[model samples]
Target: MVSVHVTTEVFPFDQSVDLCPDNDALNFTTIFLITFGSGPTLFSNKTPADFNFTTSHSQSFTFDVNDGMFAFVNEVPDLNNGWHGNASDYTTNDTDGYMFLVNMQGIDPQIFNYKIDDLHIGRLYEFSAYVANVVRKEKCLNKPNIRFEVRAINESGNVIAKKGTGDVPACYNMSWSKYDISFETTHSSVVLLMLSNVAEGSGNDLAIDDIELRVYSTNDLDDTSTTASSIFDCKNNDEDYCECSNDFIGLSCKIQSDDVCSKHDNNTYESLFFITFGSGSDRFYSKTASDFNFKTDLKKESWSNFKPGAYAFVNSVPSSLTVLWHDAAKDHTTNDTDGYMYLAGVGNVNDMIFNYNITNLCVGVDYEYSAYLTNVMRDIRWVSVTEPNIRFEVRAVHKKGDLIAQKSTGDIPVYQHMTWSKHGLSFVATSSSVVLLMISNVGGHPGNDLAIDDIQLRVSSANQTGFCYPG
Candidate 1:
């Protein structure tokens, strides 16, 4: 029999044996309960009485074998080897059917024995061993050594768990050896046991005694008693107060102590207004409400934010304004600045410069003539003089025709708006009398290739809208 070391007050196991106490004041083999001052107390069996102490009370207890007796001894002469059972039958092959053997030839007799089958799963077993060298050996003499091994095996003969050490020094004469083996089972199985010392030839003579094993079950472990806010109260696997998070594929779980990991656009008006033309690139600018000149292809136009109702004037030029006259005998090359303007390539048919004539001006009045031009690639020729060096001169034939206004060029580039003043002059409308605003090639050629964006001949302020021009 092997005994585990326990304090008279309370202490953990000191050997490799199952403990089964009979009172409530004691403990089971595999569990531990902690108390102040003393570190931890272990038990192999439950005690039947409560531990009623008043700091001065003394209680004493004793432990003895509860069930079967396992013995390892040699009855001389025939030499036994290990732990032996009582019953045997040679007809069935069994390890327990014969007596254990110990060879005592040329060396002293030796006995290495232990017991550990009583511990259950999730139990902590503490153990220690003692050995006596009955015949000390020095140089070809007898010396005894002991080894211990605990293997948890299932019913199918599989060794599922094992932990042990095999080197224990021997003691002279009647001596004691001690060791503690702690084991916990993760599966349900019956344990197989072995105790020996490097089983080989000669030099073996010792007796092993007082082997101890104590068990600690799962219920014996303690829980943290502090509050949640205390750092000491946190467990290793708890995630609420994580210290670090695992990182995988741009996603991660934060290990923050008390926080959640979170994706972090700013919207402004300056980012909205973008210039989309030119190259495929974009440029941003403040969207201001004002007039601007828009250009496309080879043509240019003046546009403004002001909208028009009914009709609008491009300068003093009216929308769809026209001039009309028909004469088969007249040369009609005279330049007229009465209520109309001219554009290049108008009447240069087959080299005969046929000028357009505005025929029926109200007699004896003033009127204003204006011209507008866009994308003027070359200098255009114009007859600005009222009197013709050819056949006619521009005079106010009506009171509205007297206001012949003219300007060389308007303030807007690619946009021309000139008015001819006819306020002080007047003339009569004969049958062949015609008005002209000639558009011949200036600086020596024809086909000036200029666009007349919007031209008009309206009474002053007839259908005027806001004009788009530079100040």
Candidate 2:
């Protein structure tokens, strides 16, 4: 630390001293003393209380500071033109007036009789400066801005720390800019600092004040975390209520028991078959459970061994417009048709089998029916008729039992081999009603027995609904 005191018989002007430090040699803990005045500046080997002066008195003492820290004094002119300065050794003869008075504050003001020594490195240091200006002679430059800077260097005289050329602003009241200076301990080696006016040109006078320096080490702080981790769980038995959790890698599934059904992700099952019965003791049989073939006619005995008034009726419920099938007759069961519809020779050589009914149907839907005869029993003689002659013809009547459509097969001689015949008729119903299919042989011999099989009823869609199978 450096200390000083001042007393003058008369105040002269203003004065200051500078002390530069070695930042490398000092580990920590350093101090400096600084003083200011509007009059003469004193740096004698005297205490401040022992100093004497008249108009105004001041003293500034310089002390060597560490490279990380240094001490210095600065002053700015107070006027745009006039003179200002500090006096050191005053003469009783009033001859040697005073130190160089700073002419003006702006536009390249100079530092007169100022010198620095002793600087250290790698230590935290404080620095400050002051300025006073007299503008009685010339106009100050435009926009007078000023700044201070510091640097640290090694014993090799290499500079380690230096402030950039940016200027620090000064107030008219002579405010000081105080800050710490530290040298980066690595490469170069030297420590120094400076103060200067920025650009120039200003109306009012300016000054610097209360320059100081201190040195120490910097303190430490604390630390924290970066990202967040979280999880979600869903546990209700609703297919639509569960969420796709992070554990499954964002893939969703209906959880049956902690795991999902492996086949399809979110789909379940629906049943396949349904039936509604109306009339007749009809039985359905399939070689397999998945088989769709249905035998349409009632089981019967022989066709040639005619029996009177023996007939059977099949019923269907009409839900929509569809194609359906019915058996008019079946003669493969036994040797006797004890009670049956007769087939007789006619003038048209037509034999007719009457009354086939699908008694149950939806009220307004139309239906088409077809009879397929797979095996026909025959005699040896040809039918006494023209080509395409028929032994029987099947016709359908609407729910009111009125005839709507008819179909018949071409005749085959008794000596001809047997073949299956597919006979079909189409009709539309005015109301939901049951219709009877009647078979008549119009131009051929009767007594040919037939066996029928495989019947179906199907409803089809003309267009599609918007929903699709989720799979």
Candidate 3:
């Protein structure tokens, strides 16, 4: 070894210059490792039906068939100690189909694995599914959580992308909620998706259904058709750096922005008046004046031609009453057979269908109010029937003449399939309270029938006055 020389002499260079400047040219980078392509085909569920994949990391699984049960989609889960929800698989709502149950105890937690072959290099994909906790208790002791991993199979197998599903809390009564994770592929045309358990204790029991792999972005970080070994440093803490539009967030920028008040974000929606009508195991529960906040009264009859301001809380639409109407067995929100909806039989024009005064409003704050409504008149009608049109309005509760905002569901036409469309508007509250109104713009006996559900008012977290919208 040569002797080291500690030179005390000053270098013959300018002292004000930066000696150890950040040389970005020679910095260790991995952004160029993947060649991002433009115009990738957006797709869903690349794997076979219900994740039936032949290839996996290992061929062994400890799924106990004894604890695994099967139940029909539209029936109650009473046979399996009510482990699953009353309404099972979200996608296949067939009454004859069954959902396969899973057991908690197993040797290895890595129960599911699927290999995705057709992938555009440097493209982003998101895997999502509906998960439910079956513990039936307040605190989750053995709740099932999932860990997702995206592995590049055809390359060096160096990619290790992962995401975790935190403890899926119980809703006491059976409930189904969705969870998702995003990942980008690099260099490899084939990626192996591995789903494993990452729970702490035993009883990792869960009900899973409707697995899908959808494209979040066509390219990686807006770079198309250019890749190097180690070009620019374009990541921070293993997350891809993206210039996301304001409505999107997260590393991959795949998640839509939301708040505690919104349900479209798949988070627990908190609203001032959370009107679900009523809920039960698998029964249609009736309501009183308190349920509607003492605004309107229910009709003695649920059929057509009752009167103005008369309503019925029904779960299933009896098609025998109106042959031209659509028969919907499930509610719009819960998709449960026993979930109730407000079936309105309009009598006169401009009649108030439902009205309630929402109190304790935050001044100068934005809020979104909406109601799900479906026109009962079938699209295949022989006669020229007038479609139902409802006007939603919000007025200052103290000052009745001061109108805050108004919007109308202009001509709700019936589709071949039963569909519920949301009708409402966003407003900035100028007063402490507002009278929320739902009125029929045009009404008659045979043409103005409609069903309503999930009326709510929540804080508006997204605004179009910013960079997010007009993107």
Per residue, candidate 2 scores C-alpha lDDT tens digits across 237-352 of 33243122311110112223222212112213211111121222332221221122222222222333323222222221111211111133332212333212112122232233
Model 2 worst lDDT run, 10 consecutive residues: 221-230
Instruction: Return whichever of 1 and 3 wins on lDDT.
Output: 3
Clashing pairs in 3: none
Model 3's number of clashes is 0
Candidate 2: C-alpha RMSD to true structure equals 49.5
Task: Give candidate 2's whole-model lDDT.
Answer: 0.27
lDDT string for model 1 (176-263, tens) is 2333333344444333233332222343444333333344333343210100000112122333321112100000112211111110
lDDT of 3 at 312: 70
Clash count for each candidate, listed in order shown: 96, 87, 0
Q: Which ten contiguous residues of candidate 3 have the minimum total lDDT?
A: 223-232
TM-score of each: 0.24, 0.24, 0.41
lDDT of 3 by residue, 1-471 (tens): 111121111112222321122322122111111001111221111222223333222211222123322211222344344354354443332333333244444322443555545555655555545566655533323455454456656545543344445344444454555554445556444443434332223445565554445453333332111110101111134442321222111112223233422334232434556676775543234565456683643353545544445677777665766677777545687755477777777766666777888666766666667778887767652334445666677789874447675545545665667787666656667777678887765544456788888888766444322111121
Q: Rank the candidates by lDDT, best first.
A: 3, 2, 1
